[model samples]
Target chain A: MFWRETYIVFRRQLRMALRNPAWVIIGLVQPILYLVLFGPLLEPIAGQLGAQNAYTLFVPGLLVQLGLFGALFAGFGLIAEWRAGVIEAERVTPASRTALLLGRILRDVLQLFVQGIVLIGLAFLFGLTGSILGMVFGLILTVLLGAACAAASNALALTTKSEDVMAPVLNSIALPVLLLSGILLPMTIGPQWLQVVSDFMPTKYIVNAIRELFTGDFFTITTMWGVIWTIVLFAAGLYVGTRTFRKENA
Target chain B: MIHARGLARTFAGRGRGKEKEEVKAVAGVDIDVEKGEIVGFLGPNGAGKTTTLRMLTTLLKPTAGTATVAGFDVATQSQEVRRSIGYVSQSGSTSPEARAGEEIMDHGMLYGISQKQAEARGRELFEQLDLDGLWTREPRAMSGGQRRRLDIAMGLVHDPTLVFLDEPTTGLDPQARANLWTHISDLRVRLGSTVFLTTHYLDEADALCDRILVIDHGSIVASDTPDALKRQISGDLVELVVTDAAQAGAAAELLARIADTGVDTDTTSVSARVRGAGHEIPGLIRALDAASIELESIEVRRPTLDDVFLTLTGRSLREDA
Candidate 1:
């Protein structure tokens, strides 16, 4: 029943999302722009500075940036539904709280996946080729990271019940995560203290996980730690999100 | 069937930054709704009608007492209670972007009905509510009345044994309201589902409810069938529309002198509460004549639910929130 409700809500959300062509167009185009513009512009600096790989570094940062943006927007749709009294209606039904949360997270995950695919395609176009297995692993990492961030953002949205708060909060939290995750540049290039701070951010692990996959460094301890952090973040996000929802209903 | 006793719910104001004071939304109250009965829970705004409905539907837990909906305790067995009832709130719940048929089917599936059964039930309800032609149209495109009908259809799709409708016709036009009552009546007759409804429309309750419970200040002030409650106000109400404010006051004074009747005066009208209108009408007209109060109009009507509420509570049923 949880899966069924999640799928139905996902379908409904997608349909509603499609009605606004601007969102769809922006989502499809923004990641491509990040890949094409940011990747090439940083390539010269990467080579001169002996950076690991420009496209490899750029892809994870773009993925986290896009994922955070997408997850942050997830709450607006829910708030709109709440204001419209649709959420109240669903509450009166036998729909489980778990199902409700699952549905919302699934919708965000699906959207993030679509955005990731567009970014991946653009990455290949920018001469960022990878082994099929590496590409698959990277995509998997991106999805888990995106779903976690989206779920966390959704929890904030449901609790606040204000889109104005959600938008600014999303930007404030996501911007720093994107900047400090070593997505645009290698963490080694940064000051030691800054790298330590980046280590505390989940985006750092996400970027590292995907970068390690692309570099065929899957056996490293960092990869194992990154996987553990991804699971921890996803679980924490789901827990906090669900708790916020229950609190709102109360 | 539904049973609630000493039900109470208090909501704390938003945010930890505020004080810890709580607003009592639903105070101690008891109610019993039998199977296959339509009970109208009547109250003015803020009288705790919606709050009580929320408790019975297991959406809000009672702070003090117990409520068992469909034989499942609301606090302990909420999921079972939820499974057994359908709730339609004052705010319409259907998604504006969803087609009417899709909304109904989606709710059916959510309530645990099989996909095939959900589709079949959705189609049947759509046709039953006269929504067969507009199944594909989104709610935003439908008329207000159509949207309300679709909401009702969605509530009924799961075929629950009990349904709670909160101010179901508040904004509906009279014709639409009538149409909804017709569907409600049919539901009772066909499926024998107990319907617990709250509304400010006394006439709607008079026409449709088997019993009416008038609540005030978080308490049930009166509960009885419409006829029995109305009869408690006296035989009939006679309104002597006088020529002016002074004349209406004079008329009231004259009528008050008569036996076994009470006269209440207002700005432009004087209403006399009398028993056995057949005998009182002659005496009332004589008193008006003696006071030289020219009666512009005279209306002798049976007591209505409004009168019963007015007499019992000393206020109108449509008091502002």
Candidate 2:
């Protein structure tokens, strides 16, 4: 019954998403620009990952980049929905609060996945190469990260209930996480202290794991840690999102 | 179908420095609503009408006391209470991206209605609310009235036994308000659905509500049928507006002789509660004229819910909103 209710909300969100083409168009412009403009600049750093082509080494970071940035702003849609009285309207229904959060979180994941695919397609155009299995794992990791970030973003959005507060706070946290996650560059090339700092960041392991997968190296500690961290982030995000939702209803 | 005893809500003040007072949004409100009855909750700004409605709808927990809606405790069996009621809040759902019919149908689906049943119910509601030809148009393209009707339809799609409308006609034009009132009245007549509504419009309450609950300062000041409440304020109200503002006091005193109840005065007008004020208007005019007060207008006004509120709280309902 809960999943049924979630599906109903998910379908509504899906219709809303389909009706608004601008979200996808706008969401795609940033990561595509990074791929187009920044991918070539990382060629010198390719040797650090023992890769011949820089695009393969850099594309994995961009996949997570798409998810991180995409999911970080997912709460904007929810904030708008709240302002429209959609969230308040749902409060009167028999639908479970968990379903409400799950429905929206799933939609955000789907949206981020679409954006991830577009980024990957652009990566292929930019000469990124990898095993089919690696690409599949890469997509799954992006989606997991997106789900976690989007869930956290939604929890904060509901907590603050104001976009003015949400934006600056998310930016402050997102930029630091982005830099430390090594989304734009390999953290290993930086100073030993910087690498140590990056180790504390969860997305850093996912990035390293994906980079290893891109090189067709499946049997590595980096890949295992990446999976563990991504799963942890996923579980943590779902827990917080669901708890905040139930709390709001209460 | 609805009963509340000492239902109250309080919000703690923000800040740790100094003693910050907590705000009591709804303070000890008690109400009883029978099945298939239409009850209107009338109150001034910050009078806790919405807070009471939220508590009844299980959206907000009362800080004190208890209530049962649809035979289920609002605090405990909230899910059963929710399943048995429909709510249309003041700030309605106007999704700019969704077509009107689809919005209602989707809302019904959320409550576990099948698509076919939801569509049928949506169409019926569309016909009932005069929302035809809006199935294909997004709310952004519709007028405020159309969107509000859609909001009502969304609430009704599940066919609940009771409905709560919190200031449903607010922000609507007069014609739209009238149209919505017709549909609301029809809800009780056609479906036997109990309606608990909150409105700022006194005439709307007088015309539709079987009983009106007047709340001021977090307490229910009065609750009765409109005519019963109005009759408590004595006879018809005589509103005398004179040209000479200075003579208002003297005019009120003169009218007070014939009036059975108290006389009220403003800058240039005197309103006296009198038995048979319509028949006594000639005497009132002569007495005011003898006092050298030039009459601008003399209106024999019947006792309204506003007068009942004014007599009870020394405040006008129109000014309260």
Candidate 3:
């Protein structure tokens, strides 16, 4: 019954997403621009970072960046859904409340996957090189990070319940994530204190894991921490988002 | 179809310090709705109409009450209650970007109906709700009235035995509201679905409801048929426009004799509520003529649900809403 309801809700969310897909591509634009305008600048410093080229290093970071920013602001849409009475409408039904949140999280993860593929496709044109398996692993990490962020974002949206509150809160969280996670530059190049602080950030571990995976390095401590953090974040997000949806359902 | 006793909900205190006091939104109200009865849950804003509706629909749990909607306990068997009833909230639930027909289909499926069955029922509802050629139309693109009709279609798509509508026509224009009323009335005639609707519109209660339940301050004030409730008020409202403003006081004295309510003299007008105004107006005109007082016009209006509310609550429903 739970899976059946999730599939029904998933189909509904997908249909709505497909109706005006311009937003999906629009969401990808920011990551693409960063890849195009900012990536070549990293090539000169690529040797210092111990990569074959800047594309390998920068592309993984951009994928992580996309995963974080792309999914982090999803609360805005959730707030719109809340105000539009979609949640209340669903609550009145016999549909599973957990299915509702899981279904939307699945939709968000699918969107993140597509955007990651698009970002990787453009990076290949910019002289990127990596083992196929490693790149796939890297993309998986990006998507996992996205699933976690999307779920957390939705939970935040349900809690705040208004765009005005959601906007500033997301903004405050977004700045630290974008700057501290080293999505643009490796934290190894930053101060020791900065690196220590970034260590506490979830995206920092996922970024480090994806960067290493792209270089065909998988069985390392960094990658292990990355997988663990990603799972923890996803679990935490699912827990909170489901709680919020269930509370609201009651 | 719906039975509730001492159905009450109390929200915990939100205010801080000395101001913190739990608010009883619905204070032990008993409600019994028969099958196929189009019952109007009439109340002004903040009168616990929506709160009671939510409790009955299982969206809200009552602090001190029991409600069995469609023969299922609201608290323990909520899923069963939800399956047996359709709820249309005041905001009109539909994703703005989703196609109208698909939205209905999805809602039906959520009720555990088959996709094929949902499609058949959805198309029929679209036709019934006057939403032809809007199968693929997005709700955001539809007009206000059309959106509301789509909401109704979604609710009925599951074909539940009971329907709960919370202020269904709150934001609709008169024509659209009246059009929706016909569709609502048709529900019981065609499908035998009992409707329990909440509304602040007195005319809607009179025109659409078989019975009206007036709620005030979290309690049921009165419950009866519209005509019966109106009869509780003393008489029809009568207003006399005297040609000479100076004769208003004299007219008031004469009008007071026939009035069951107090007569008011306002410049050239003397108005009061007169029982059986049809016979009394003729006598009133003759008395005015014998007194050599010229009259411009006399208006008589039958007692309405508003007057019923006024007599029951000591406050006009219109001003409160």
Candidate 4:
């Protein structure tokens, strides 16, 4: 019943998304803009970071950018749903409460996957020289980050309950996370104290791992930490998301 | 199909030190409804009407007491209760972006019905509810009445044995309200669905409900058929205006004999509630004429539901609306 309910909700959300896909296209603009505008700047510094090219380094960071910021704003949709009484209506149904969270997370992950691929394809056009196998592996890490971020965002939406509050809340969270995770530049280029401060940011591991995987470097401690952090993040996100859904109006 | 005893809910007062103070939203009320009955809940704002509906529908848990809806316990067997009932809330739960028919189908499917059956029933409901040719229209694009009908279609799609509508016709124009009333009555006639609805409109209850329950200040104040409740007001209101101020006392004295309640005199006008005013009024007018009292105007009004509401609660329904 849980799986069936999840699939039902997922299908509904997917259909709604497909009907008005303007948001999906609009969501990709920021990452593509960064890739097109910022990739040439990273070329001169690529060799300094010991990479074959800037695309390999910059593309992975853009994936993290798409995954984090794109899915972090998923909460705004939820607040709209709450205002529309969509969540409260579903709560009255016999549907599994946890299925509501998982179904939405899966949808977010799929969208992140699509946006990541588009970013990757555009990166290759510019001059990215990365392994096909490694690119697929890197994309997996991005969607995992997306699933976690989307789940966390939804939990926050329930607590805030108003778009006026949610927009500024996500803004405050996005800035610090974007800078510390080194989404645009490598944290290693910064001073040691800065790197130390960024060490506390869990997103840094995923970004570093994606950059390594793009260079066909796998089976390393960096890759393991990234994989572990992703699983932990996804699990934590699901836990908090499920708790909020169950706690809501029970 | 529904039975509840002392059903109640209490919320911790919102904000700061107020959290320690508990506010009773539903202060214990008993309710009962047999199958195929259309029951109306009438209450003023903040009167716990919605709170009681939430408790019965399993959208909210009662802080006290118990309820059985569709033969399942709302607290312990909520899933079974949910499967057996449909609920359309006050706001009418439809996303502005979703197609009306698809929203109904999705809602039905969420209750464990097959997609094909849901679609079939949704289409039939649309046709019956006069929502034809609007299958693909989004709620945001529809008129106020159309959106409300779409909401009703969503709730009825799965064909639950019992349905609850919270202020279903609110915010609608007079013509739209009249149209929805027919559809609401048809539910009990066509599908044998027991309806429990809350509304601010007295005429809606008189027209649609087999019985009405009046709730006030977190409790049930009165429950009876609409006609019976109207009868509870005792008499028609008779107001007499005298041509001269000095004649107000004479008019008041004459009205007092036929008045079931006390008569009121204010300068040139005198008023009172009199039983069987249609029969008693002619003699009183003659008595005034024989006493050489000249009358300015006289109005005798039949007791209405509003009069009953005023008598029971000392508050008019429209006061807080």
Candidate 5:
């Protein structure tokens, strides 16, 4: 019954997404810009990192970045729904609270993957190539990470109940997390202290894991740590999201 | 059907540096509603009508006491209560971007109705609510009245035994309000559902409700049929606007002998409640003529729900709102 409602809600949202093509286009612009403008600048360092193509090294971080930035902003739409009484209307229904949330977060995950695939296709056109297995693994990690962020973002938005506070707080946290995750450059090439700091950032595990997967080192320690951290983050995010949703509806 | 006893809701007050205080919004409200009846929950703004409705609908937990909506405990068996009841919130529930028909259908689907059944139900509601052509339009593209009709349609799609509407016609014009009132009045007749609604419009309550519950502060100040409540004030209202400003006091004094309460006198006006409205007008005219007060005009008016509220709370409902 719960899954049925979740699927129904998922389909409704997907239909809305299809109706609003501008959102999809806007979601694609940032990742495509990175592939177009920033991919070529890293070619000199590509040889130093022992990679024939710099696009392969850059694409993984961009995928994680896509998920991180994309999911963290999902709450803006929810806040609008809250103000419009859509959330209140849903609360008065017999639908499970878990389903209400799972449906929305699942939509965000699907959006991330679709846009991630678009970014990957653009990378291919720009001369980026990698093991198909590695690319799929990276895409999977990004979706999971995006789902976790989207869930946490929704919880915060509900608590604060204001876009004014949510926007700045998310930016403050997102920028530092992005920088420390080494999306622009690998942390290993930076100072030892900076690398130590990056170890504490959860996205660093994801970035390193995706980079390994991009290089076809799927069975390595990086892959194990990446999967474990992503799982832990996803669990925490789902727990927070579900609890907040239940409390709000209750 | 709905029954609530001592239902109360309190929220932690916003405090800075001092101890937090609890603001009691719905304080010990008791209500009894029979099946197939339309009851209007009337109150001034901030008088806790919406809070009481929320508690009854199981959206907000009561701080104290208990209630049963549609025979299900609002506090314990909330899901059962929700399944049996539909709610139209103060803000219309339709999403601005969603087409009216699809949104109503989706609302039914949320309550476990099949797509084909929900669509059929949606069409039935649209026809009934006079929202036939609006199915393809988004709520934002429709007028305020159309949106409210869609809200009612959404609430009724599941065919619940009871429906709760919070200020269903607060912001509409008179014609739109009248149109919505007709549909609301038909709820009990067409579906055999109990309609519980809250509104600040006294005429809306008087025209549509079988009984009205008046809330002031946090408690229910009065509850009865609109006519019965009006009759509670005693005697018909009389207003006279005399030509002689100085003689108004004398006319008021003369009318006081037959007036049930003390006559109210302004510069050139005197008004009071008098028994036997049909018989008292002549004597009042004669008395004023005898005093040579020079009558301008006189009106004998029946007591309205507002008069009943004014008598009980010492304030007009309009000003209170």
Candidate 6:
């Protein structure tokens, strides 16, 4: 029954997203623009600096950026629903609280998966090719990371109860994670303290995991650690988000 | 079908730095609704009618009290209570994106109806509520009355034993309100669903409800059948419609001299509460004639629920904002 309700909510969210075609176009356009402009600008510098597969390096960073953006927008959807009175309507229904939270997080995961696939296709066009198995691993990692960030965003949204608060809160967290998670630069080149701080950021793990997969260096223990971090972040996000959501509803 | 005693709810004030003050939305109150009966809960704004309904429906917890809905305790057996009762809030429940038929079916499915059975029940209710032709249309495309009827249809699609309607007809026009009353009466007769409804319209209670509970300031002040309530204030209502303000005042003074009775005067009319209206009419007319006040029209009628409400509460049922 819970799965059924979750699926129903998922379908509803997809339909609503599809209805606003401009948002989809806008969301898709941003990362594609970054991929087109930044990919070539950094290619020569990366190779001259002895970075392995400059295009491949850029792919993971773009994917992490897109994941964070997708997760932040997903949180905005919750605030919009509250303002529209849809959340209150759903609360009075018999839908399980757990299912509602799961459905929202899964929708974010799916959105991030779409964004990741589009970026990967762009990477292929730019002469960045990887094993099919490697691409599949990259996609899975992107979804897990997206789900974690989305869950955290939802937790913040529920606690604050205002979209004005949500927008700034997401930007403050997301921008720093994007800048410091070795998305645009390798941790080896960054300051030592910055590298240590990146160790605690979930996006850093995602970027590392995706980077290793694309370079065919997938057997490293860092990859396993990245997956473990993804799992831990996902679980923590779900726990905190669901608890706050239930409290807000109550 | 429903019983509540000592029910109370308090909401803590907002923000971190502010003192934690609790506003009692619902004070200690007791109510009972029997099977297959329509009970109208009458109250003005801020009278705690909606708050009490929310608690009984399990949407809000009572800070103090014990209550059972459909034989299930509201506190501990909330799920069971929720399953057995349907709640139609003051805010309409129809989603703008959902078509009427689909919305009803979704609610039925959530209540555990099988796919086949839910579709069948949805169709039955749609036709019964005269919404068969509009089933394919979304709520945004429908009229207010159509949407309100669809809301009622969705609530009944689950076949709950009891239903709570909070100001169900507040936004509806007269014709739509009448149509909703017809549907409500049919539900009682066909499905035997006990209805616990709240409304500000006294005539609605008189025409539809088997009993009425008048609440004020978080307390129930009066409870009885509409007729019994009106009889409690048994007296004659004498309405003297005059031509101008001067004549109205003169008529009021004449009626005052005739008897020590309750009197109310408006811009162009004077009304008096008198015992034995037939006998008092001649004396009243003679007094008015002596005062040189010309009466354009006079009406003598039995007390109505409005008068009963006024007598019990010292306030009009329809409050002016």
Candidate topping DockQ = 3
Instruction: Give the per-residue lDDT of model 4 (tens digit) for B32-71.
Output: 9999999999887788999999999988889899899999
Candidate 5 — which residues are off by over 4 angstroms?
A248-250, B233-309, B315-321
Q: How much is B306 displaced in model 6, in angstroms?
A: 9.8
Give me the displacement of residue B300 in model 2, in angstroms. Answer: 9.3
List where candidate 6 sits over 4 angstroms from the true fold.
A15-22, A48-50, A79-93, A152-165, A182-200, A245-249, B228-248, B251-321
Whose DockQ is higher: candidate 1's or candidate 4's? 4
State every prediction's TM-score relative to the real structure.
Answer: 0.86, 0.90, 0.93, 0.89, 0.89, 0.83
DockQ of prediction 4? 0.61
lDDT of 1 by residue, B131-235 (tens): 888878899898778888787887788888998888888888989889989988888888888999998777788778999998877888888997777667765
DockQ of 6: 0.26
Over 4 Å off in model 2, which ranges?
Answer: A48-50, A248-250, B16-21, B234-307, B314-321
Global lDDT of model 4: 0.89
Q: DockQ, in order, for the candidates?
A: 0.51, 0.66, 0.72, 0.61, 0.54, 0.26
Better candidate by TM-score, 1 or 4: 4
lDDT of each: 0.78, 0.86, 0.88, 0.89, 0.88, 0.79
In model 5, the clashing pairs are none
Model 3 lDDT per residue over B122-230, tens place: 9999998899999999899998889988988888988899999989898889899999999999999999999999998778898899999999889999999987887
Which model is ahead, 5 or 6, in terms of lDDT?
A: 5
Model 5, span B1-321: residue lDDT tens? 898999999989899998999999988988999999999998778899988988888788999999989999998899999899999998778768878888888889999999999999999999999988888899989998989989889889999999999999989998999998889989988999899999877778888999999998899999888878766687888888889798888888888888997899989889899877779888878888887889889888876656777988888878846
- Colliding pairs, model 3: none
Docking verdict class for candidate 1: medium
Model 2 C-alpha lDDT per residue in residues B57-134, reported as the tens digit of each score: 999888999999999999999999988999998877757877887788878988889999999999989988898888
Judged by lDDT against the true structure, how good is candidate 5?
0.88
Best by lDDT: 4
Give a tens-digit lDDT track for model 6, residues B1-321. Answer: 988899998778675898888887778889998899999998778889988988888778889999999999988987788788888777676567656776677667666676678789888988988888887788889988888778777777778899888888888899999988998888889898899999987778877899999888788999999877766675677888987787887788776654437678998888877767889889888877887788889998765545766889887767742
